[model samples]
Target chain A: MTRRLPDPRPQVEIVAGRAHVVGQQCAACGLRTTLVVSACPGCRGELAPVRFGPDGTVWGSTVIRVPVAGRTPPYCLAYVDLDGGPRVLVHVKASTEPVAVGTRVRLRGDSGGDLVVELVR
Target chain B: MSHQAAVLGVGTSSFGKQPEVPLAQLAWSAVQEALSDSGVDARGIEAAYVGSVLGPFGSAQRALQGLGIGRIPVITVENACASGTTAFHEACWAVREGRYETVLVLGQEHMSSRITGAIPPDLGDPEGRSGLALPGVYAMAASRYMARYGLTLRQLAQVSVKNHGHALGNSRAQYSGDYTVEEVLASPLIADPLTLLQCCPISDGAAALVVGRAAARRDAVRVRSCALRSGRAWGYRSEHAWGFEIVRETAEAAYAEAGLGASEADLFEVHDSFTIGEILSIEGLGLAAEGEGGRLTESGHTALGGPQPVNPSGGLLSRGHPLGCTGVAQLAEVTWQLRGQAGARQVEGARIGVVETMGGGVAGLDGNACVVAVLERP
Candidate 1:
C-alpha cells in the first residue's frame, strides 16, 4: 500500500510589493483627495484611480534598530508623501544619518516598478 | 467599561530551542495543561485562536487538528513577537462579543532554526530589505536614544542582569543563568549599545490560557479588563518611534477601562524585545515617569522582588523570544501569580496584574496591527 503526504506549504499567501506608482482617487465627491494616497485610513472611501507623479517630498523619517531586509543598521527609512495620491515607505541610499523630514524627493520605482519609493532630495 | 473575564487555567511548555517537538505538540502541551486546570475539556471550547510568529509551515491547522480542537475555527495571529498576545486579544474579544462562552488562547512558536541564521518576514519587507536586522533596528534606535537622553550601555546591561536573576528561578524560562551587569556589557556587541547578553535568544516555547466570562474562584484568576490597540499615526506625532510616550497613551486607556489607575497593578510583563524596551515600557506603562526607567532599573525598583516587579519570567530577553508564545507566557506568569502558583518565582501578594504585549516590527508598531490586554484580580 502507498501513502500520500500533505503539501508542505502554508495556507496563507503573503506577497512582497516593490516600489511603483499606484493611483488613489475619491468616489463620493468625485474629486481627487490630497496628492497623498490616504483620504481616510480609519474609514476609507471608495477610492478610484488617478496616476501619481514620479517625484515626492519627504514628510517624515526614522531609523530602525531591529532587523530589516535590504539595508544594514544605521540605514534610513522615510515617509515620502508623493505628488499624485499615495504616501510611500522608502530608503535614502545616500545617507542614513542627518536627513531631515520635508526634504524634496523624486519618487523612484524599484527595478520591477512594483514598489514605488523616493530617494534623498 | 470594566469587563469581568477570568483566567481559569494556565499552561506552558518548557521554553528553549526545541526542534524535537512538532509545532502542534508544543501547542498541545499547553492545551492539555490548561484544559485540565480549567476543568473544561475541548468540548467546552466554543472558539480557539493560535498565536505563532513562526510555525514551521501550516503548524496551526496541523496542531489544532491533532487535538480534536480543530472542529472549532482557528485563527492564527502573526504580529511578530506580539503574535501570541494578539491571539489573546482576539480570543477575549470573541468572548466580549458574546460569540463564544469559552475560548482558548495559545501562543506557541519554534525558532530553533535561527541557530543557522534565520531572517524574519519583516526583513523581507522592502523597508527591512535595506538591512536593519533586529539588532541593527533596535541598536539604531538606542544609539539615537543615547544621544538625546544621555543613556549609557551599562544601564542597558543592568536591564539584562536584573531579568537574568529573575529567570534563575523560572523553570519555564528560555534562559535562567545568572549574569552580572559587567558580564552583560562584556558579552560582545551584537548591535552598538546592545550586547549578546543584552539581546534575547530566539526561543521555542508555548503558553496557553483558558478564559471565560465566569467569576474566578479563590483558586482562579480573573481578568478585569483586556484592551489591545494598533499603532496609529497622529501625523507628525513622532510618538511611534519614541518609546513609552506613545505606548503610555494605550496603557492609560486600559487602566481607565478597568476603573483603576496604574497604582493598582501589582505586576507587569511587557514586550521587552530589547533591553531598552523594558526601560521605556516601565515608564510608558506608568510604573515610572518619562525618561526614568533607566533610573528605576539601576535602583532595583523593577526587579522581581522590587516595588513593581517586571518580567519575573525573565521576560523576552532571558525567557527566549519565541514570538507567538511570549504574550501568553506573560499571561501565564500573571495567572500563576494571582492564583498563588508561581513557585520560587512568585511575586508575593500580587494582584491586579498587567500583561502588556507590543508586537510587530519597529521600536513600536507604527499604527499597524497592534493589541494590549489589561487583567485585574476582580
Candidate 2:
C-alpha cells in the first residue's frame, strides 16, 4: 500500500467559482502571512488556514523584458497586498500597458498553478 | 596565542566573459599572483578556504592541484554572492585564533561556462516559482522606492553612468564607457525602471588573498573588523526595503568592532549588483539617511573625486559580477587602495576603506546573508 503525504499550505484555491489566495493566521498574535510556515514568525503561535483576496493593491511590479527559466519576455510580475493582511508575489495578466504600483488588482484565476491577478478597473 | 589578522597580499583575474578559461585555470591565476605578491610559496600556506557558488564539487582541491601545498585542510564555503568574503572572514578568524599562521582565501566563478542569461532564482522558493527573477525582484524595489520617494528615472541611470565611467581607469574591469544618462536609459530594458546597463553582466573571474597575523608583515593592511549576519524575518510593517535592515545590522556590528564611524572611511566598495542596489546599500551602510540615497547619488557625493568615493574599482556593475568572486574582488580593491597601488582610480591619501557584500534571497526574509568588513592602513 502507498500513502500520500498531506500538504497543509495551499497557495491558491477556487471558492464559489472565484480564485482566492490562501495564507496562515496566527491564533495568538493574529498575524497573517502568505508565506508557508509551521509556526508564526512574529510570535511563534499556532497558525490556522485563511483565504485572502480576489482583490488587492499592487505593492510593487515590474515588466520582465528578458526570458528566464523558460518564461517568455514582456510579462509583468507584481507583489500584491491583499485586502486582508497577507502579501503575495504573483503574475499579473499581460495587458496593453504595464501595471502601476498601488493600482487595485483582482485575482482572475490560476495560470500553470501560479496565481494570476488582473487590474480591478 | 590570539593575534590580529591582516591581509598581506591580494590578486584577481581580469573580470569578463572568458569561456575559454577553465575554472581551475581561472582560480590558479589569482592564487599564483596572490602567493607571489605576498612573497610566500605554495608550501608556506598552512590552510586554504575557497568560495565558489556554482563551481563543480571539490573545486578548491581541483584549483590547488600541482601547488604542492601537501595535505593541508582545504575547506570550501558557499554563501551565495557573499561566498568570497565569507571565505576571507573565515581565514581571518583562523589566523586570529592562532590556528593557522597563514591561510589562503579564494573566490572564483565562471559564469559564461555555466549561465547564459539572468541567474535563475531558486525554484524551491515560492516567489521564484512565481516567475520572479533577480532583476524582477530589484525592479519591484525600484518601483516601491520611486513611489515612496519620487525617485526619477534619470537619477537611477546615473549610477550606471558613474560606475562605467569609473571603470575606464580599471584595467581589469569587464566593461567601461563614458555613458550619458540618456545613453544608459536607452540601453535595452531588462526590467522597467532598470536598463541592461544597470544590471551587472555575467562574467568569469577569480580573486585570492593571503591572510596572516598582523605582526607577520611591516606594511600589512590590518583587518579592523569582519561582520557577517543572516537576514531576519521581515513583516509587512517594516519600514525599509527587503535587504536594508540586514545590511544596516551587519554594518553596525562591523563599525562597533572597528571603532570607527562611516564618515571615517575614505572609500567604499559596496555590492552594486544592480543600480538600485548601490543606493540601497549606501543607505544601509549609514552613508545616507533612509530614502536619501537617490539625492546622495545625484549630488555626486559618492563619485570618484567626491568626499566619499564608492566603487572606485568600478563595482560589480562595471567591474563584472562573477558570483563568488565579487566579494573577494572588492576586498582586493580595498587592499590595493589602502596601499596606494590602485593606479588612476586611486583616492588620494586614502587610509580607511569599507567593503560590503550582501547575498542570497529567500522568502519571508530581508536577505540570506551579508558580510561587512573595515580595513585600514597600518
Candidate 3:
C-alpha cells in the first residue's frame, strides 16, 4: 500500500495570476484569521478554510536593516490587513522610500512560498 | 495552609557581553549572592525553579550542581523573555500553597557567545519565516503609533535618552552614557525609526531571587501580586496595537489582585527591549492614556526623579537583555528600590513597585506571554 504525505507549502494559492492566502473563518462567530486552528480562538467554534485577498491596506511596516533568518540586511516587513478580513505578516517590496502606514497594497506573489505584497499604484 | 510569599533576597550578575563566562558560572554567581543576601544555606532550599531561553538542556541542574542543591525538585521554565519572572511566579505559588517554605528562582542566558546579530525569530514561527525580526515588529508598532498619535521621531528617541541616562547610576548596567535625542537618532539604524541605541544589546547574565513565606523575614519585600497571561488571538479588528491589549489586561489583573491602581506604584520596571516598547508598555500599564506615553516621556514624567519613575535601574535597553535573565533582573531592581537599597538611582520613598515583562513573536497573536507583578515594601 502507498501513503500520501501532506504538502509542506504554505496555504497560499495563485488564481487568475493573483495571490490569495488560505485562512480560516469561524463557523459560529464569522471571525477570520490566518492562523491554522481547529477551533476559533474567539468563540471556540468550528473553523473552515477561507481564502483572503489579493488586495489589502498596510497596517504597519518596518525596514529591517539587520540580517535575520538566513536573509541579508535591508528588507521591508509589513502587516497587511486583507480586504475580505484577516491580517497577515508579509514581505513588502523594498523601495528607496519607506512604506507608509495605510498605503493601499496588493499581493504581488510569494517569496519562497511566503506571502509578499507591494504598493498599489 | 495558605501562606503569603515575599522576596527574602535578590541578586544579579553584572549585565554585559561576557562571552568568557559559562552559563553555569554566570548563574552560580547570582545564586551565591542571593544565598548570601538571604542568609540561606544551599541545603535549606527545598525546591528550585530556573528559566532560560537559549541555555542548554538541564541548565537548572547543571547550574546548581556545585551548590549541592541537586537533590531538590528543579523545574525549568522557558517563556521567551518572560522566563525569569515566570519562574519567580511559579516559585511564589509554590511557597503560597505550602509546597515549599523556601524556594530559589533563577534566570540565566548566555547570548553573547552564541548570537552575533539580531536574535532570529523561531524557525517554526510563520512571522519569523516571513522575515519579521523582533526589531521589525517594534518598528512597525512605532510606525503605526506615530501615524495614529502624531508621535515625533524626537519623542521616540527620548525613550532611549532617558533610559541611557538612568543607566549612568546603575553599576550593573552594560552600557551607559549621557545621550541626546540627536545622538540617539544619529546611531546606526537597526530598523527604520529604531536605531542601534534604541535596541537592547546582546548580553550574557543571570539573576536570582529567594522566595520564602512572608512571616519568615520581617524585612522582606512582599510579593503583593504576580499575574501572568498569554496573548489572545488578534486580528485586524482588534481594538489596539499588537501587544497593547495583553499588557493592559495583564496589568489590570495584577492591579486588581494587589487591590490598588497603577498610581499607587512608585516605580516600574517594564520590558523596554526597544525604545518604542517603553512607550507602549507605559500606556498599556495605565501610567498614561493611550497615545499619551510619548508626551509623558518627553515631559520627563517617566524619568528617574519624576513622580512615577519607570526603569530606574536602566531597563533592558541599558541594563542589557539576556532574554530569560531580564524578568528576574527587573524583579531584583524593584526589590532594591522598594527597600531603599537602590543607591544613586533610588526612587525615594518607593513603597510599591510594578514590574512587567512581555515575550512575543508568535504569528497571529498579541504576544506569546506577559507577566505583571506588584511588589510592596512592608
**Best candidate according to TM-score:** 3
lDDT winner between 2 and 3, please give it: 3
Off by over 4 Å in 3: A1-9, A94-96
TM-score of each: 0.77, 0.96, 0.97
N/CA/C clash count, model 2: 0
* Candidate 2, residue A108: lDDT: 81
DockQ of 3: 0.51
Off by over 4 Å in 2: A1-10
Tell me how far the alpha carbon of residue B366 in candidate 2 is from the true structure, in angstroms, after superposition. 0.9
Model 2 Cα lDDT, one tens digit per residue, B90-204: 9999999999999999999999988888888666677777678888888888998899888778889888889999999999999999999999999999988789999999999
Instruction: Report how far off residue A121 is in candidate 2 (Å).
Output: 2.3
Model 1 ranges off by over 4 Å: A1-121, B1-3, B113-115, B121-124, B234-246, B362-367
Task: Note the residue pairs that clash in candidate 2.
Answer: none
Alpha-carbon RMSD of each model: 7.5, 2.6, 2.5
Model 2 chain B: worst 10 consecutive residues (lDDT sum): B233-242
Clash tally, candidates in order: 40, 0, 0
Instruction: Give lDDT tens digits, candidate 3, residues B237-354.
Output: 8878879999999999999999999988899999999999999999999999999999999999999989999999899999999999999999999999988999999999999999
